[model samples]
Target: MFRISQYLRELAQAQATGSYPTPRERHAKGPVVIWNLIRRCNLTCKHCYALSADHDYAGELSLPEVFTVMDDLKAFGVPALILSGGEPLLRPDLFEIAARARDLGFYTGLSTNGTLIDAPMAARIAGAGFDYVGISLDGLKPTHDKFRRLDGAFDRSLAAIRHLATHNVKVGLRFTMTALNAHDLPALLQLMQDEGANKFYFSHLNYAGRGNIHRDKDAHHQATRTAMDLLFDHAWAAAQAGSLDDYVSGNNDADGPYLLQWVRQHLPQWEEALRQRLVAWGGNASGQMVANIDNLGHVHPDTMWWHHDLGSVRARPFSQIWNDTSDPLMAGLKQRPRPVQGRCASCQYLSICNGNTRVRAQQLTGNPWFEDPGCYLSDAEVGAVSTPFETPANKHARRTIEIAHV
Candidate 1:
């Protein structure tokens, strides 16, 4: 994930001579764990990566088991933990687990649908001292409700955000972009400003679980570029106006390169500095900086890889599973200059975006090394030149020279 707002601000304020500061390097000890405490959700979202339903899954970890995992994470020096779910608040011990995580010195965050966060619940969450709360709001009333597969969901979620704000809880909005909701982005940004949201997380749709069914509906290249332009403009303007503090994009590392290009064209002076900062940030951290532990304690490189299990916490500890490089996928993911195929292999900005999202490539092409189908950059943009540089006579001379050597 790239925090474009913060990076842009840093670049705008930085001195010309010195390099900007880098974010804390991840995966030195353990990946930030996105623990799915439960798999049951009230609403069936159109692009739900989990395909979570209203019914209970059979093998969710118990409270004691969750405590055990939390203890292990703390011991392993995991920097942060995000409690996610079909709807995490639906868990009976949600607050208790959150409190326990805090007690153990974890930077705990909550990811929820927001419809379940009422006034009293908001008060409880605030009192629990969660580091942050991210609530999903896809778009305005009609669009959001349709995406959520329920009417009145938009009003209820908006009410929840207001309630959380009233309680002084640090809350952010999570919006997943697709053809259905891309048009609503401007209105949604205005809503964020009006609602006084602390942050906005923009996610590009990834093909997984229920999302795979809607792959055709993913935003086209132009739409994606337009959406990103809107987000950058709003976020940059908000920073200048001293409104929102954070704006991030996820599920696609191509965003980093895209932002670099934007800076090159618009704010030419900051281009070099921003490029250095992005290279240090190192995009696409799955299987390295990020990991997912599903409701059943199965470990994956990321949330979208629910179908591809690396290991099981029930059988072995998370630290053990994450550190075991014998697994081919895990090993390849941690390698520098990853063995990626097609355009991603030859991208000029490979240092910034480490092969984009491997899961997307795997999902679309049935080979994880293939170019990510979700990458919105063009061949020219990514530095893919089909024709060879040498002429036919030069090529024949080179072939003759190689034959002499053979």
Candidate 2:
């Protein structure tokens, strides 16, 4: 994930000459862990990648087992642990686990649906010393309620956000973009500003679990560009106003190139600096810098790869699973220059995006090496004539045309 608001502030306001700071770079010693403590949720959201339900899942790691895994992760030098779930607050020992992770010196965060966080819950979360809490709210009342598959969910979620804010829990808003709710983005941004949210995370819809069923509803190319423009504008304004400076986009490393293009056109003077910073950030660090331990203790490269298990914490320690290069998928992901195929293999920004999201490619084409179908950039924008599916192009002519347009 990239914080566009911070980048814009550092570029235009601070005029900093050095590289932009990144969580990945700052915590170079260990990978960020997404630990799904539970798999039960009250609401069946349309874009739920976990495919979670209201019922309890069998084989969840026991409390002692979870503690053992947490200890191992801490010993392995994991810097941050994000407690996620169908709804993490639903767990009986949620706060206890969070407190334990904090005590173990891990920067703990919570990912939730927000409906379950009442006043008491908010206080407990704040007391647990959670570094951050990200609550998902798709849109305004009607839209959000529909997406969440429940009426009054919007109000409940908003109440939770307000309650968290009152307790000074450092809460943020998480909105997953799709064709059904993209139009509500402006209103959601205003809501964030009005609610005094500390951050805003705009997640592009990824095809996994229930999300795969809605892939057809993912934002189109032009719509995605327009939405990004709105986000950049809003984030830039927020930065200038000295409020809500953390604006992030996730599940799409194409966003990096998109932002670079935006800076080139709007903030031309800082383009080179932003480019250098982005390159250093080294996009899509799924297998290398991020890992997921599901509720059942299966280890994946990232949270979205529940279908692709690299190893199991129940079988081997997370350190051993992460360090082992025996798994073909894990080994390929660790390779600096991955052996990607199609447009990804030819992309000039390979160093910047690291082949984008492999999971998306694998889902769409049934091959991880194939280019990500979610990449919305045009051939001209990516400095390519065509992809494998498109007609072969005259490279010189295409380059001349693109240069002239620029």
Candidate 3:
């Protein structure tokens, strides 16, 4: 059985002792809570959901407010808080706030537009004792500016990233991939190569932002579909060729192994061929792909569509905010725990909790995130990875699909 009990137990003990747990300790041991200090940003990206005019959030988290959240989270035992915003630096008291959080024993971090990250500012942050930072770099320069709308945003951001790197600050690149940047995958990869960014998360743009929210769905989706095809084609091709193996080789042991094994199984003979393709793929796809906080305190998780209470974040006594009882989008949350059977019940990852965003999934597929798309066996020792196909059925149904042609 897939029991995460051990994982949970280890996490609890680590937090209790103020020492990070094993697997999590190796990387980031925290549950990663986002503090939306504000929502107003100088550059308007159209893909923002909480950007609507109606979304009114207090400009900043007051010291008392910040203290409340920190104390609560500390009590509840969340290990970290990632402070983001329309721009976190926009709030003048950022360092003080961060210092307070750090003093409270919560691992404090920041996400920024990089426009404000200077040597002095960086020093303040380092002195304030933030653990890490995430920098947004959609492309080298041209593409990034087009999306962020600041003329020199890309160069400045890149400069900030390099500056942080020089200061020995750990940084990760944030790439929100979109239909526009979708075809430019290779370009993005090259930029990352130049930047020495170790972590890359690809996200799809969502419908909420300043962009064409009410635009033609078919056309937009089609363009996205086309872009995805091109992007995945390169990815698949890279896997087919030897290009992926090279990237995997470049990836440190832990970093590249999963991607390598995943490609080996999915692309098979062309695994090396897949690696050969040159990629400048756009950075992480954008929008609702991952939940974020706005300048205000709206803590939104990408998978769920609801405004989570910031106080409840990392705060146990505050109670869980997104539980079905409190979330507006999840009317069915407490309805009943649907009994699983057949494929879902017996599947390896049966304790699957990841579901689609309530609003988007309901509107798009009328079905929530019922499938775990990223559940491939990335570790070679896990055994063969399989895709749905016509073959001898493992379990019978009137009509059946089997794991075939792995």
**TM-score for every candidate vs. truth?**
0.92, 0.92, 0.60
Model 1, residue 405: what's the lDDT? 100
Residue-wise C-alpha lDDT for candidate 3, range 1-406, written one tens digit per residue: 0111222233334435655343422232223466667665666765554452223355555667667766755665566777876677877677888888878877777878787788887777667777878777776677788877779988888888777877777676666555566556567666655776544444444333432263232124444334333434444444334332112111011112233334466535433432231111111111211234434344554322333333333333332543324443333432322232223223332222222123333333333333222222232333324334222343354244343422
- C-alpha lDDT values of all predictions: 0.87, 0.86, 0.48
| lDDT per residue as tens, model 1, 338-369 | 89878777889888999899988787666787
**Candidate 2 residue 238 C-alpha distance from true site, Å:** 2.5
- The stretch of ten residues in a row with the least summed lDDT in candidate 1 is 384-393
Instruction: State the lDDT of candidate 2 residue by residue for 251-346, as single tens digits.
Output: 889988999999889878778778888887888988988899999999999988999988888899999999999988999999988888787888
Q: Which candidate is the best by lDDT?
A: 1
Candidate 2 off by > 4 Å: 14-25, 385-406
The local lDDT score (0 to 100) that residue 393 gets in candidate 2 is: 54
